[model samples]
Target: MLMTSEWAIILDEVDELSNMILSSEQAHSLRHAYTAVYKDEELAVEIAAFQRMKDHYEDVQRFGKYHPDYHTIMKKIREQKRALDLNERVAALKIAENDYQDLLDEVSLLIGRSVSDAVKVPVSNPFFASSGSCGTGCGTGGGCSCSS
Candidate 1:
């Protein structure tokens, strides 16, 4: 069984590994590269159009059920959503985020498993015998059950 001090050593190692430069750099680079690839002209235009349609839909809804522009605004909103969906950059960004998330999740699970496995019941006192009291009186010369 691992003692408390042994468990502490495992936890300390996990913390050190989490803080290492390589892991930090990989996470940072994955995020930065993903964002850099997403900052494109067409994707921005689609995003803006989607936002505009969303706002227009909201404004039209205020005019009640018979508002003349309600159906047209709703249709435009759906089309804008589709446009955004069709953009390849959006898909790439999602993939990148998912990949990074998977890596992070794996690391977290490993740490949790290791820490759980390291825990143990406290050790019995070194000086005390399991059967009864401590010291030379335990099992010598009629002091206890043992035959000398």
Candidate 2:
């Protein structure tokens, strides 16, 4: 391996971007939203109940409804899950998360495409699909040859 000045510069720029992102307003918003949700008394109760019900539900699932507690566990799990999912704090947290994720994804997509169209950047949005792939199956039977 050899250290190149160009690589060093790239690494520095990456660090700069990383620092900017960590201190960005969206990052702060996300953190605040997460903390708000985490400290909500109602959400905490719902989350705990859901977790406990889910654990029991999973155990009953292994027995395929034949377990004595299957239906009760399943019903409780669904109720708790619905309550949690429909909570206002959880909704705000999800919005904050999506905003933060979008910002990160945009930066990654810009960097990836700037380097080459072949570079793949995973994103939540589907319209930005990149070209190239991890593999191309060895064509037709075995008679094919790729030019080097």
Lowest lDDT sum, 10 consecutive residues, model 2, at 129-138
Name every residue pair that clashes in candidate 1: none
Tell me model 1's lDDT, rounded to 2 decimals. Answer: 0.61
Per-residue C-alpha lDDT of model 2 across residues 1-148, encoded as one tens digit per residue: 6889999998999899999998998899899998998798877877777777788888899997789988888778887777877888888888989889878877877787789866656666444332231123334453333211
Give Cα-based local distance difference scores for all models: 0.61, 0.75
- lDDT per residue as tens, model 1, 1-148: 7579889998898678777634665577666756765577666776777888888888888995688988888888888887766766676666666666555544544454466633221212322222232323334574554323
| Top candidate (lDDT) | 2
**Candidate 1 C-alpha error for residue 66, in Å:** 8.2
Model 1, residue 50: distance off in Å is: 2.2
Displacement of residue 41 (Cα, Å) in model 1 is 2.7
How do the predictions measure up, each by TM-score? 0.46, 0.74
What number of clashing residue pairs does each candidate have, in the order they appear? Answer: 0, 0
TM-score of 2: 0.74
lDDT of 2 at 52: 78
